[model samples]
Target chain A: MDEQRFLEYVQSGGQVETTDRMPDDYRSKLVKFIEMHGNSELMGVLPEREWILRAPTLQRKLALTAKVQDEVGHSQLIYRVVEDLGKPREQCLADLISGKSKFHNVFHYPTKTWGDVGVIAWLVDAAAIISQKALLKCSYAPYARIMKKICWEESFHILHGRDVVLTMMNGTDEQRELVQEALNRWWGPLMQFHGNPISKEDDPMYIWRIKSQGNEEARQQFLDGYVPQIWELGLTVPDPKLRKSDDGVWEYSEPDWDELKHVVTGHGPKTQERLEFRRKFLEQEAWVRSVVLAEAA
Target chain B: MSEKVQKIVEIADDELILGWRDSEWTGIAPSLEEDVAFSSIAQNEIGHARALYELAARELGTDADTLAFDRDPGEYLSAPLVEERRMDWAHTIARHFLYETADEIRLAALKDSDDAEVAGLAAKMDREEQYHRLHARMWRDRLQDEPRFVDALEELWPAAVAVLPEELRPQMSERLQLDLPSNSLLRGFERGSHSEELRPLLDEMTMVRRSVPGATW
Candidate 1:
């Protein structure tokens, strides 16, 4: 099919498979977008993995470990989809470590306390799941199918996050303070997570139906769904202008699009440190991969 | 503590410490697939630890979390094998394979315990551990010819035997087709003494719990 026909097909909700003929732009765009997602899942775990060892209870430890495992599992699934699209997982990892590709802006920041853990699982994953749910309608069939499992596991993560927050809120003043402090620190990244409020018509990801929603639409959905939950916990949102309009559209102060662009471009505070950490491990373990792959070949 | 409770806690401590060490590999394992698979094994080990702790908790008037996170470093009953920090894949897999082999023998013995409760819990844990053993065996197969893996197995052998009681050591040795070390050699690495690693591990493990004393996490 020609590029125009392929565009018309995907625009009307048609799905594309690996074997299907398609335009070079669609295929390349799909690989880039999907590879970043795979990278995010992999990097996303490092911030939370720090807390796994320090989790306060056995229950929390197990739950957190399982959650991190699911993320790594998600990365495995996502990278496989990327691999099937012609990019090797090794190439993806190399590009990620070398800062030749990008992950979500949120993961580039550091996780601070147990409170950060709660906020991340609760808020970070919430923002993530909104984007993921929208991808359930992705024109890429393999990527869309995996979102079903990814979305289901992510629901449990949000519950785990909320549980951590609720327990802290119900406890001592110090515990509640931890939650609020973490929320305060994380509020900015959470707002900036869905990307700048680009219209779907112009965003190529949306133009090709790689994602089913606009950037602003996802950020709005997140605000509409979560702001009430945040407030009902008697916790304050850091944004002064964050509120619902009479027409039911949620309004908030403009997020720092500059920070979002800078972070995803690998200049966030923790981005270099995280990439270095990943680079160290990947280089150190290169021999093991060689062994396994050589034996298989 | 009753003899039965002490025995249960010993095994629980091994599982808890081993699981903690195994989980340190969550995102940094050799491959993403291994990271996920290894983490499942780690979670299962911790789950087994919790179940064993609960069994002992019933007799001690405490709960599993209290037993798990609230203990002093010197008081933990884990052996030196699981306590050592070996983050390298060779050492990690060696420990995994060796510990799983030792645990299989230990659990089999417990499954025949006269105490029905102990026996029942052992049986359930064994069922879950089947996967762990399979995973360890799969890695062992892949890495069997790799010199580093072979060296790791040999280096960790004494500590692996130390994970078991004197009587169980023979069974582990037989299963692995390796001869047991002298009683004196094994005795030095046995349970009852805390490794230098355990104190630091315990400090990090309990840091959050200690931060908010007595608060639900």
Candidate 2:
């Protein structure tokens, strides 16, 4: 199909399959966008997997392990979509390690304490789910179908996060302080988790219907749903300017778009270390893959 | 602890530590499909540990969390075989195949124990472990020809046998169709001996819980 017709088709809520004809630019854009998501879900595992080892209770350990496992499963599901788009999974991994692609801004930061654990699962994932919910209407039907399961699995993470935060909030002063301190560390990243407030008309991801909502719309939904939950626990978000307006739009200090740009381009605190970790395992385990998956090739 | 309760704790610790090792591959498995599949097996092992811990908790007057996290590194009763660090996929799968083969025999004997609770939990565990056994055999069949996998199996085999008592180990060998190495040829860690690795593993595992003692996680 021609570019104009493809655009019209996607904008009008039509779905495109893997084998469908499309403009070269649209296919490239879809590959890049979807590959980064696969990268994000895979990269997302490193931060949480550390806590899986240190989870305070067996129940917490199992829950955290399962949650991180789900993230990995999501990555697997996502990368398959990317692979179907013509980029191989190994190529995606190589690009991720080489810093040629980006994941969400939040995953680039370091996770500090158990409190960071709760806040991440609660707040960071909350922000992500907001974006994922919009992708249910993604013009790429395969990507959209995967998002359905991804969103469903993530539903527990928020509750698990809340349970963790609330229990700590109700505990000793030290425990409450742990939660507050972690929230302070993570707030900036969480605010920037959704991209800058570009208009949907200006954002190609939105114009092509790869993402069904504008950046600002998803962030507003996150703040609206989660701020009350945060406040009710007597916890504080680091943003002094963060609040809801009379008409219900969340007005906050403008996110450090420069920092978002810098970090996503591979200069965050833990980016190199995380990438190296993945590279090490990928190399160390290459033989296993060669042996197990050789026949398919 | 009573021998019966102590036996339960020993088995729980084995599952707990091995499962922790298994879960190290949550995102890094060679294949994404295998990563997800392996992770479920890891989760199942931990689930089995939790159930076993709960059974022991009743007799010890503590909860599963306390028994799992409050104990010192030296106090964990896991086999020395599971205590060693293993991240290589070949080693991981090799150990997996060996451990599951032995676990099947171990669970079978427990399923006939005179202690009703022991016997009952064994029956449930066997039901759950059916998948683990199947997974192990499947991987074993696929990787049996790979030299590294074959080498890992030979290396880890002794430790795999050490998971069971001498009385039940012959059955493990019989079913696996491999000769059980003499105890002296096996350099595997003994049941009563915790490896140097176990201390650090336990420390990392309990770091968060240790930070705020008595705080709900």
The lDDT of each candidate is 0.92, 0.88
- TM-score of each candidate? 0.98, 0.97
**Candidate 2's TM-score:** 0.97
Candidate No. with top DockQ? 1
Give candidate 2's iRMS in Å, 1 decimal. Answer: 1.1
lDDT value, residue A86 of candidate 2? 94
Complex DockQ per candidate: 0.87, 0.79
Q: Residues A1-297, candidate 2, lDDT per residue (tens digit)? A: 788988999999999999999788888999999998889999999999888878888888888888988998899899999999899988998898888888888888888889988998898889989989999999999999999999998989988988989989999999999999999888888888888888899999988999999988998899999999899999887889987899988899988899998998998999999999998988888887787677567
lDDT by residue (B1-217, candidate 1, tens digit) is 9888899999999999999999999999999889988898889989999999998898999999999988778779999999999988899999999999999999999999999998999999999999999999988999999999999999989989988888888888778899988877776588897678999899999989999887888
- Worst lDDT window (10 residues) for model 1 chain B? B181-190
Residue pairs clashing in model 1 are none
What TM-score would candidate 1 get against the native?
0.98
